[model samples]
Target: MASITPWRQLLLDSIQANKHLRHSEYFQLATVKENGRPANRTVVFRGFIQGTEKLQFTTDARSQKIEEIKTQAFGEICWYFTDSREQFRIGGFLNVIGNAETNPLRLKIREQAWFQSSLDSRLQFAGPSPGIPCVKNGPDDNTTPKLDPAEGPVENFCLVTLEPQEVDYLNLRKMKRYSFVKTGDFSWTQRELIP
Candidate 1:
């Protein structure tokens, strides 16, 4: 089993302390577009990959972020826990696991995410291409098709993983802050920072 880093432990603690708030499960992901512009969006945090430090999230394959990620795989996630007045900026590289994935483990991970998603969540992947104009009653109709929760992911559904390289954690209430950078496979160097 891969050992958990100190920052990961802190993040887990923060998640437990603020589990009651729905927003605590959300974080802002920033990526650089092909045109050299930055794009940001809110993404729900899926649980970490088993026996790994990678963080997981789901996204539509047709979303603009996919192209952005292709242009630049490096990105950062900024997560804030309101109840705890804590924030974490995690910088890392992202991996998109889609229908074309051939690795057995990655395919299994994608399948697990699909099965774990709610029916309504899975239905979104069946809808029209995302980021396109929505029509009242045309092909863009927002009606969701029935999807079996146990079924595997659709073509448009992708499991994205973030491999953290650096983390900056801040606690507002205590006026304390720390920065951590990955030093080895399971080791990190932490430094105190002025909040």
Candidate 2:
């Protein structure tokens, strides 16, 4: 058996150790527009496509971010690991995860989880609904509403894919960093970086 390189070891460790990173906390995604300007937002990571090395996240179909990606297929993702004092910046092409017929199951699951986690009895009817005025109500009036996983807001869901072409890792311990560009399948061209 062959030994794992330090870079690969670090990446594996970071991914496995933190379950939060597996969700939508550390992903800072940036997408460009046809005018060459950039739009960025913090997105939640839904899952990874193991075979193609693609990262997945959820978004709204009518969101400005998705519209921007439609104009530009390239994007960048920044992942910061506070525990390891490391930051990973991945730049790659953007891909939409579904077709006209097929729905994004992964994104749906994540959305359901997010909805369930954020449910307050007082805020059950607080979503976007016609004729529902947008005004702050008293806490007593904001009772948590029951969420039906099958009947929640599913029409607005979508998934964004990030195919990393370049990944740069910065380590705060040694004040060292390494940059990796996709060279071949499961392989990369690595370069050392200045502190």
Candidate 3:
């Protein structure tokens, strides 16, 4: 299906392309740590929320990124497609969803995700929190954690969403680029940029 707008199409492209990608999400996420330093990591692309201004990804609630997001809601996603020699950088406000206080839209997605995720995936979040050191490394241990005895949705599952305030798309093959800045709610002012 063709997208209604170029901006939507670009984002949709990223979401659709993520499926064939394994080594990366066809993008990278940059979040600011509480210490005012930049931290970049790879995240799987979930999808854009319908009739809204957000992109989604799943993460362990215990991940350090959660703390960073709680401190600062600002973040960016950089998407590059080698096949098309194109790059799309999206800067926006980020929010972590999947709790009692989270809105229903995100809650619904998280609910579906919980059901689809494998037992092994759920077990990951049930273990020690991310960045906490342990005597034995997970891979070296030659054993994986078992699912919690209760056998329910992992308590740590969360959906991370970004609401874009700016989108910059560049096409190296054509030597051109454009920038779109949010002008108002669900609206943006676009401009061609010097590539």
Q: After superposition, how far is residue 166 of candidate 3 from its true place, in Å?
A: 0.3
Question: Model 1, residue 120: what's the lDDT?
Answer: 80
Give the alpha carbon lDDT tens digit for every residue of 69-170 in model 1. 999999999998999999999999999999999999899999999888888888889877878876777763656677766567899999999999999999
Error of 3 at 83 (Å): 1.9
Query: For candidate 2, lDDT tens digit of each residue in 115-135?
Result: 543344213333343234555
Model 3, 1-195: lDDT tens digits are 222456667656754664465643546999999999999988877666666667888788878899999888999999887666678899999987755535665677777666666677677776767777775755646655677544545678887889888999998989988998988765677799999
Top candidate, metric lDDT: 1
Instruction: Answer with 1 or 3, whichever has the higher lDDT.
Output: 1
What's model 1's TM-score?
0.96
Order of candidate numbers by lDDT, starting with the best: 1, 3, 2
Return model 1's CA RMSD, one decimal: 1.3
The pairs that clash in candidate 2 are 24-44, 120-144, 121-143, 121-144, 121-145, 122-142, 122-143, 122-144
Provide the lDDT at 117 for model 2: 37
Per-prediction TM-score, please? 0.96, 0.68, 0.82
Q: Is candidate 1 or candidate 2 better by lDDT?
A: 1
- Residue 36 local lDDT, model 1: 100
